[model samples]
Target: MIIQLLLIPALVLAVVSSLRSRTSLRGQARRKILAVLTVVAGVLAVMFPNTLQALADWTGVTRGTDLLLYALALVIIYLVGSTSVRFREQEARIVLLARQVALADAALRHVEAMQARSQQAADQAPVAAHRGVEGTAAAR
Candidate 1:
């Protein structure tokens, strides 16, 4: 029906997007395989709705819809957990990077301040020597 038309494409898109986002080569391969299997299973389920009922009965579930709901719930929980972990890791990396940048800035400022003091001392040296020579001449 109209729902089938809407759901099939949505399901395929979800699988593809999830598969495209991965952290490692091994994970990417695993997800790609899972995505293919999911699409195949989805196609089969759409073609034959009774198979889902049969599967539910075999699994001791009262209804196929209920089984699907349970599976969807599990998937949602897993995605939430993984997303939380990824965010935590990214936050930690950001904090470490900020600390390194702050330290570098402080070091640069300290070096500049030391250089300024040295330059000021050098600038005053000639004036101090000229005054000393003038005082000696006056005394003579």
Candidate 2:
């Protein structure tokens, strides 16, 4: 009797989860489904004390305390995993930005070099013209 009752909720949850997974439920609907499942789990767990106690003993941990600890561990691991992924993505972006900056710097330097050469050629033209005029005047 107890075994059948215990399996009933689990079977229903498994079926519902599998069905929902196939059909894409997002936003509010997904949240509502999750909330309902959580409530069902709480109700079923309270209704069946022996199953919870058996699980606690088999795992060699306290009933409620160990469950809480495990839940906390899962939450922490999920948070850290998400944070690490974001950090990696940001790091990649930073590297790309640095490469762009380096390329821009190289281009700017090349432009400045070309400008300097152009200025030097312009500066010599007037002096060369003056020398040519003086030579022509001397010949006269």
Candidate 3:
């Protein structure tokens, strides 16, 4: 009786879903396959819920929905933890790269300062040497 009651809403949803599926052949095909599979599984579950229950008991799961929710929660937790670790690792890498860039910039400034000092020494050396020569010539 409840299944009969469920049929109207299900058919309405299916029709509305089909109207939306005209945009993509793959989507339509997927929906058709899903509908067939859903009907087959629903009939099987209704007929043999006990058989599936036995399998679940062997597997130590009290209920199928409980097992499904547990599996989903485990996957979500693992993904979120891995994503957080990867994010922190990337942030550390970025900070290290920034420090390396600053070090390179400072080294460039140091090299420029050394080059200026070299130029000053080269210019003064020639002038000082010529002045020494003039002093000796003037003494003579």
Candidate 4:
């Protein structure tokens, strides 16, 4: 009775959160299906408590609750593994994007610097030519 009070709400919230999570369309569909199945199974368990016990007996488990605990453990393990892989993939993509942005910025800066240098040289050319002409006249 006490366990049901705790586990039912926790499981429902977990499913709700999973459904609300951002994922691909296919992933969202899969989670929605899983949530529906979870609710149906929960309803069946509440309506026929003896069914779980019979299933436990058939599966060679000592009790239905223990079987549930075992199943939960496997799920937790799988979620952790999948989350780790997803996190690593996201991290790699971020690093790649950062590198791309940095390279693009550096390239832009280099082009601007070259343009400024060329403009400075262009501005100085007339002054240099005037100085050369004056020197030639003074020498003559």
Best by lDDT: 1
- After superposition, candidate 4 runs with Cα above 4 Å error: 1-43, 46-48
Q: Count the backbone clashes (under 3 Å) in each candidate.
A: 0, 0, 0, 0
Residue range 21-120, candidate 3, lDDT tens digits: 2336786587567657757765776688786566456556787555445434544554455456557767888999999999999999999999999999
Tell me which residue pairs clash in candidate 4: none
Write model 1 residue lDDT over 1-140, tens digit each, in one string.
33345445656655554444346787668756866876887788778989988877876778888767755654565466556666876888899999999999999999999999999999999999999999999999
Between candidates 1 and 4, the one scoring higher on lDDT is 1
Which runs in model 1 stand beyond 4 Å of their true positions? 1-40
What are the lDDT figures for the candidates, one per model? 0.73, 0.64, 0.65, 0.72
| Superposed model 3: Cα runs more than 4 Å off | 1-66, 135-140
TM-score of 1: 0.70
* Number of residue pairs clashing in candidate 1, backbone atoms closer than 3 angstroms, sequence gap of 3 or more or interchain: 0
TM-score for candidate 4, please give it. 0.68
Model 1 residue 2 distance off true place after TM-score fit, in angstroms: 33
lDDT of 4 by residue, 1-140 (tens): 44455556666655555434345787668756866876787688778878987877776778888756755754565455556656876888899999999999999999999999999999999999999999999999
All candidates in order of lDDT, best leading: 1, 4, 3, 2
Tens-digit lDDT string for candidate 2 (20-121) = 322235734864675576677667667886776776566555675565455445435544554565577678889999999999999999999999999999
